[model samples]
Structure formats: structure tokens, C-alpha cells
Target: MNEMKTDTIETIKRVLAEVRKNPDLAAAMTPSTDIVNDIGLDSLQMITFILSLEDAFSLEIDFETFDFDHLASIAKLSDYIAGRMKEHV
Candidate 1:
């Protein structure tokens, strides 16, 4: 994979680890899980997780350009992050 894809995957893994650290949240997650439906994250938790991801990856997500609800799967999240990082560059 390319550097951006690698970075995106790493970011996703880090975010997953964060979710797994929260005992209440961990039980609901899997690598292929959907953050919203399967994990049952509310809007606040979702924003918090996104912020954590932004910090971890050193990327600024343009909220105006993002459709947050679509960030359900790791692949989608990775793609979004990769796109945002590309915009920053």
C-alpha cells in the first residue's frame, strides 16, 4: 500500500484501540464493525472519537466537507481520513 493508505490504516487501528480501551465500548467493536450502528456511539461519542483520530493522525477534518454519518466502517473512515490528509497537503 501507499504511504497515505498505510497512515490511514494506522489511524484506524489507533482509534479502534481507543474504543477497545473503554470497557463499555470495547464489547461492541470489531475490526469490521460499524461505529454507529454496531458500536452504538451517540453523536457526542462519535465527535470525541473523531477528534481523537484527528489528533492521532495530525490531520484536520473539514467538517463542512464531511458527511459524518457515513463513517461507519473502517474502510470509509480510512478513506475519509486519507482524503482529508490529502487536502491538507
Candidate 2:
């Protein structure tokens, strides 16, 4: 089944919580929120977040071509994920 972008966003929130568990996350979250800058994820946490997203979506991220620019914002990441998921399907 194809997942909606909203589902992707929600999954991101869940995965982020698992990785960071930031108390202010809910209040800080927005489509424009920068995944890296806003969340302040360390290198390890960032990797964990990516892996968790891959697992949650049941799709492997193409690190060979993955653009770190996608990490610039929540909307960008969500869009990239949705595109990747489509490719997987």
C-alpha cells in the first residue's frame, strides 16, 4: 500500500522521538524545521535516525545518491522519502 506524505511526516516524528526524545520536539516541529540544525542531532544520532527511517518505511536509502540537502528541512526530507518509497514500490 502506498503511504501518504502525512504518514511519512508522522513516522518521521516517531522515529525522531526514538532517536532524540527531545521534549520540545512537538512544539518545535514544522515543515520548515531544519532536521539537522533544529534537532541538533550528533553524527551517531543522525545515522540512527536515517536507519530508523529506512526500517520504518521498509526501504533502503540510496546513500550513494542521497543529498544531505534533504536534511535541510522536514518538508524536503519528507518529499525525498516519499519519492524513494515510490521508487521502491
Candidate 3:
């Protein structure tokens, strides 16, 4: 894989770790977990999680352009982040 893909994977792992720090939240997450339904992440928590991910990756996500509901699974989230990062390159 290329560096961008590697970075995307790392960012996803980091986001998962941050989300998993909460016991109640951690129990619901899996690679295929749905952020909204399975994890029960509220809007505030979702924003916070995305901000944390942005800080960790040093990338800006156009929040206005994103559909939060689609960011359900880790793979989907990773793909989104990767796409955003590519735009900055």
C-alpha cells in the first residue's frame, strides 16, 4: 500500500482508540460497527470524535460537505478521511 493508505489506516485506528476509551462506547464498536445505531454516538460525541480525528491527522474535514450518517463503519470512515486528505495534497 502507499503512504496515503497507510496514513488512513493509522488515523482510523487512532480514532477507534479514542472512541474506545469510554467503556460504554467501546463495547459497541467493531470494524463493522455503525457509529450511530450500534455505538449510539450523539451529535456532540460525533463532533468531538471527528475533531479528535482531525487533530490527530492534522487534516481538515469539510463538515458541511460530509454526511455523518454514512460514517457508520470504520472502513467507510477511513475512506472518507482518505478522500479528504487527498484533496489537501
lDDT of 3: 0.69
- Writing each residue's lDDT as its tens digit, candidate 2 over 1-89 gives 23587777777877787789775575558777788888889999999999999999999999886898999987789899988988978
Which sequence of candidate numbers ranks them by TM-score, best first? 2, 1, 3
Model 1 lDDT, full chain set: 0.69
Q: Show model 1 residue runs off by greater than 4 Å.
A: 1-7, 20-32
Taking all chains together, each candidate's TM-score versus the true structure is 0.70, 0.88, 0.69
Misplaced by over 4 Å in model 2 are: 1-3
List, residue by residue over 8-80, the lDDT tens digit for candidate 1.
6656656665754664454444446676666666677677787888788798778798885546676677778
Question: What TM-score, to 2 decimals, does candidate 1 have?
Answer: 0.70
Clashing pairs in 2: none
Clashes of 2: 0
* Candidate 3, poorest ten consecutive residues by summed lDDT: 22-31
- Candidate 3: where are CA atoms >4 Å away? 1-10, 23-28
Better of 1 and 2 by lDDT: 2
lDDT score, residue 1, model 1?
65
Error of 1 at 71 (Å): 1.1
Shift of residue 29 alpha carbon in model 1, Å: 6.0
